[model samples]
Target: MGVIKHQSIRSTLLIYIGFAIGAVNIVFLFPRFFSDTQFALTRLLPEIAIILVPICTLSTVPAISRFFPYYASHLKDKENDMLTLALGATIIGFSLFVLGTLFFKDAIIKANIEKSPLFITYFYLLYPNVFLFSVFGVFESYSGSRHLTVFPNFLKELVLRLLTTVLIVLHYLSWINFDTFLWLFSLLYGVLLLALLVYLRRHKFLYFNFRISRVTRRLLPKMATYSLSLLGASLFTLLANNLAPLILTSSKGLQDVAYLTIAQYMSQLIMVPQRSISAIGLPVLAQAWKDKDKDKIEEVYVKSSLLQLTYALFVFLIIWSNIDSFFQLLPPNYSVGKYVVLCLGISKVIDMGTGLNSQVLSTSRLWRYDLYSSVVLLALSLPLNYYLINHFGLIGTGYATLLSMLVFNTIRYIFIWVKFGLQPFTMSSVKAIGVALVAYFGCIWIPLAIHPFVDIVIRGILFLAIFVTLVLAFRVSGDITSTIYSAVNKIRRRQ
Candidate 1:
């Protein structure tokens, strides 16, 4: 928990910084610079790659966290065949990925041409995008297995966003046209992959050890079984999360997809804390299981839940409360995504409240449950997406995602509780909910000014005052209060 907390704080700072850069890109730069179709292409490319990453990496992402402990603990000098297995699987997966993309090219183009014809022009870009991200995921997970979490977060969050901003700015200045801009955008992942490779080499974690002869054939079966199951789980989860963009691009036009992308971006901002904590905590969960330290794992689980819930509620309220003002800062066409923001924001809150449930499960002995849950999520979400998008338009896709995540998290939560006797809720959980509601309602009566910025600042301050005061008074989380108090004391001493 200590290490998780320390790394998570640093990672959170980096992620938020990245989010700041991304907010500028998504809110101001893209809308102001690129046309709607171009903007949708930018967002959709990543979404497509995201949906492909699981299979492209052959589930190496979770495999590293789940199985690395066993290999390192048993093998000499903390060495194992994990990387060799992962990389080998990835090469084969990449081959298949290329073949599959080529085979499905016509179908994909035909499907999107009606509504998002511009996508066909850049369709080949998806292959490279998927390949680069697959390599990145493999290395990132390996780095995480070594407990080198913060750097990967920096690479993904800050460094990548920084690069994206540069490219977008270049595009804005007419230094590069749309095709070059889009290609460079995909290459950002390649740059990050190179950075990660350098990091791994510096740390001497980059050595490749097949170790086929050392480990008995018996262990091979276990490894294969685990990887296959996790691959299914990872694939399903990715599809569920990233499929909305594709569905939107199909049912609605690319412009509507652009709108949904903005809403999704704003909603994802609330997930910084959860993402940071989970990134650092997965390996910790794995180690705890290795040590048979159920108490430590439970501590991590509960603390993560409480902390994320508090942060999630705070961010959601702040964003939603000022959502109108935030949208006003964007172009008028983006206003159509206001409801999308609400739906996705609420869904992210639900995701946060579930804490590190999925991480804990994936790294624990009950990891197989993740496969089942993900299968259910995919099965439920695809049809829901089809039906909802047909009936309700763009925002319906957001609703589909919201409902999918709700069910997905609920299933994970129940399984954790029943199997491990672990749950994230405490008396403080109830108090945190109360605090959020009070702050929301109490600040609702504030008058809106003519200037959206002024209204946002004033209303944000009032909401923060009410929310933080009640949370501290009620001691919703001792960790949060102590940190605040400690910072305050440092300031006082300096004064």
Candidate 2:
């Protein structure tokens, strides 16, 4: 709990900072500075790489979290082969990816050539993009194994995004051509990869124990089975998530992809707390499962659900409250994504409200169930996305996302509840929602200023005032209020 508390706050803060920079980059800079087609390429390429990186790492990210305890218990600090295993696995996975890419290269180009020529023209850059993300993911996972999540989170959340902001700004200033911008952006992951490596080495967290331990050899069979399940789980889940944009890019065109991309970015704001909590939860949940500590796992489950829902609702309501004002800052064509943000925001709220069920299932004895869940996700998402986008256009993509996520989260929720009797709700859960709604409705009617900025600030301040006061008064989240009290007590003690 202490680790979750300490790290989640910092990680969430840094995540928000990254999102702030990202908001500028995505919401403001990219739309105006880059054309629709160019912006679409930026969004799709990284998305494809994100899906590819997990495959290139053989899903070692989760494997590292779930198995690191075994390595730690059996070997000395520098003698554990976790780092060696992760790095080796990703490189091999990347090699296999290269082989597959050679065969599918023409097919990929042909698939996109009709509607998204920009993506095809820049197709060569995707490999480097994926390779960098692949290695960076490996190190990030290994570092997480050491319970060293903060630095990696910093590098990924803060450093990478800041660099991106700079790159976009550089482009905005016409310092580089679009081709060079695309190339530099792809290579940016390599820069972060280098930074993570240095951070690990300096912290003495870098170790190569290529010598396989008795524990690893014995656990190898179980791990192979676990990895295989998670491998499909990872790919299906990633592919399902990236499906909307990919489908939209190939079927509709890049301009529509650009709108979906911005809306997705906005929706990601609601998920900032989920990212922080999940990253912190991985190693924590893994260790608990390793010890067969149901009590610890449930404590994390309930508290995390409450805390995350609180933060998620706050962010969501704020975004929902000011979405129109925010979009007004963007180009006129971008405003059509209003419904995209709504549908995606509600889906993320439900997703976060369900807490760390996915992590629990993945790390627990019932780990293989994740494979079934992901298969369902892809099975549903593929057909739904294709059909809906072909029919409803951009908002149709949003509808598909909402439906797919609803089904996906519902399946995982049922799995956790039926199998383990753990659920992520409490009385405070309802109270939190009530508080968010009250605050949201409370602020919306206040007059709109002529300037979008003024409207945002006034409504934002009033919304925070109402939301925070009510949350504290009602004790909607004990974790959050307790944190505030603890900080205040420390301040009084110092005085």
Candidate 3:
């Protein structure tokens, strides 16, 4: 728990730095520098890469978390080289990805050309984008397995965005045209992969002990089954998260997809705390499962839920409370996305409330349940997104997401409870929700006349003060209250 807390705090702070850069890029720069179509293209390209990450990495990321403990114990035997196996598997998976893209290129273009014809010119960039990120994802998992999570977080959350800022600046300076900017933007992932490769090599974790002959027949089948199940689980999870944007690209148009992308970014900002914890927690959870320590796992699950609910609700209220002022800061062209922001913000809040349910199930013997649950959720999401987008447009996509996530998280929670006797709920979670609602409603009527920047700052500070005071007054979460006081005491001491 100490390690989880330490690494999570480091990663959370790093993630927030990344979010600040991304906010500047998405909220300010993209709207200012790129046309709606160009912005949509930028959003769609990385989205395609994200979609392909699990496929091209052959589920190696999750495989690392689930199997690295076993492999670590066998390192002395030099037996079953997990790194070599994962790398070999990734190469084969990437080759398959390329072949599939070649085969389906026409179908893919045709599907998207109607609403997002701008994508046709940059279609070839998709493979390299996926390749780079897939490799990066594999290494990130490997690093996490070694308990070196902070470096990858730095690369992903800080360095990548910093490089992206440089690229955007170059484009704005007219040093590069739009086409070159797109090319360089796609190449950012390639640079990221190299950076991680160098880091791993320097740490001496890049050993290529391909001792495949030493693997037992029993272990081979088990590894194969786990990898394949994780592959399904990862694919379905990506689909549930990303399919709506792709569907919007096809059904609504590039402009609408651009709108939804901004909303998604805003919503994902609230998820940083949970994601940071999960990145650091998965390895711990896997080790716990290996030791058969259900108590430790349950402790993590409950504490993670309480802490995530506290942080997520605070972020949600801040985003929603300042949404009008925030959007006003953007160009009028992006005004339609306020509803998109609101609905997706609620959806993310629901997701963050579930804490690490997916991680718990994925790292436990019940991992295969994730595949089944994700498949059902994906099935539900597709039709709902399609129908809703046709009837209600972009905001309907948010509605579909919210509904699917509510159902998906509910199923996972029930499975965890019934199967493992673990339920991540407490009176503290209830109190946090109560505090958020009160803070939100109480601040909405405070008044608004200043600049959007001033308005957001005033409203945000007021909301935080009110929410913090109430939570502390009610002792909603001791962990959160202690953290607040710790920061205050540190400030006092410095003064």
Candidate 4:
């Protein structure tokens, strides 16, 4: 429990730093500098790479999970075998994807992608990005397995974002054209790959033994099988998540897609902590499940839910309360999709509230359920996104996403509850929600009495005070109270 608490705190701080950097990129700079079509490209390109990377990398995650325990024990000998298997799978996946893209070139080009012809060029750029991202996944997975979450967090959340900011600045200064910008974007992945290589070399973990013994050959098939299955699930999930943006761009145009992207970015900010928690939790959960530690698994589930809800609620309140001001910061044209922010924010809050059930399931024996659920989501998402976007534009897309997430999480919650009696919502969960509502409403009135910036600052402080007071007064959780005391002591010590 103490280990989980410590890891969660460290990971949370790292994620917040990442979130701050991401906020600047998404909220302030991208919208301010890029045109609608450019913004859409910026968002969509990454979605394309994210979708492709996991598929190409295949079972890198499960392989990491399987090997991490061994790798931790035998760092010198096993690192090369793991890296060989991971890189080999990545190459094979990339080759197959590239070949498929070549054969289906016309179909892909005619997908009504944003910027049409221009977007097709970006597909080539995705190759390098995909390769680098896939490789980095191995490094990240290795780091997670070793309980070194902060380094990967820094590389992924901070370094990558900082690079984007630098690139944006370079473009602003007339140092790079849009075409060069695309290339530079791909180059950033190369930088990450190099960085990971350097880190591995420094740690003496970058050797490769191409022995191809019977054991190694045998392990390859098993790893490939696992990767393929995980890849299928991942690909479907990506399709479900990105289908709306694709539909919106096809039906509405790039401008509407841009608006949807911004709103989606705003909403996704709420999930930063969730992502952080999932990253730190995945390896730990896998270990627990492997050890058959049911009590530890349940403990992780409950405490993660509580912590996630606490931070998620804080972020949601801050975003919702200052939404108007937030949208006001964007160009008036971009502000049209502001309602999408509210809808998507609600969806993410629901997701965060579910804790790490999906992660636990993904890493446990019931992992096949991810593939089934992803298929269900993909089936539902296409028509839902198509119908909604055709009728409602950007907000319709949000509705489609909200409905999909609601369905997905509800099913997951039911499955976990029925299978393990592992429900995340307790009486305290209900009380926390109630307190959040009170803080949310209470902050609303503060805005009426002051300027937007001042109102935001004041209300933010007030919301924190009220929320803490309510939680403490209500005696929400022994763990949370102790956490607050520890944090306070740390602050006092620093002072």
| Tens digits of lDDT, candidate 4, 1-495 | 667677767767776787778778877887778777787787777777787877777757656765455444544554346767677877887888788889998888877654454567667877777777777887777767666676677777788889999998888788998888778877786787677778767876666766564445545676566667777777888888888777766666677777887788777778877777787787788788878898988988987887788777878888888888777667788778878888888888888988887777877777778777778888888888888888877788778888998998888888888887788888888888888999888878853544666656777888889899998898777777888888899999999
| TM-score of every prediction relative to native | 0.96, 0.97, 0.96, 0.93
Candidate 1 lDDT at 487 equals 76
Model 2 ranges off by over 4 Å: 487-495
Q: Write the per-residue lDDT of candidate 1 for residues 1-495, one digit (tens) a residue.
A: 777777888898899999999888888888889899999999888888887887877777787887777777677643567777788888888899889878988898889899999998888888789888888888888888888989999999999988999998898889999889988998899889888999989988888765663552546676677788988998898888877788878878888888888888888888999888887889889889989999989999999999899999988998888888998898887898898889899999999998898888888887899899999999989999889989998888888989998999999999999999999899999999999989988887888899998999988899999998998999998888877788799999999
Tens digit per residue, CA lDDT, model 3, 148-189: 988888888888888989999999999999999988899887
Global local distance difference test of model 3:
0.86
Q: Evaluate model 2: give its TM-score.
A: 0.97
RMSD of each: 1.7, 1.5, 1.6, 2.3
For candidate 1, the TM-score is: 0.96
Worst 10 residues of 4 by lDDT: 70-79
**How does residue 119 of candidate 4 score in lDDT?**
66
**TM-score attained by model 3:** 0.96
lDDT of 2 by residue, 4-99 (tens): 888888888888888898888888888888889998899888899999877898887788889988888878877787777878888899999999
Give the candidate number with the greatest lDDT. 2
Between 1 and 4, whose TM-score is larger? 1
TM-score of 4: 0.93
Count of backbone clashes, every candidate in sequence: 0, 0, 0, 1
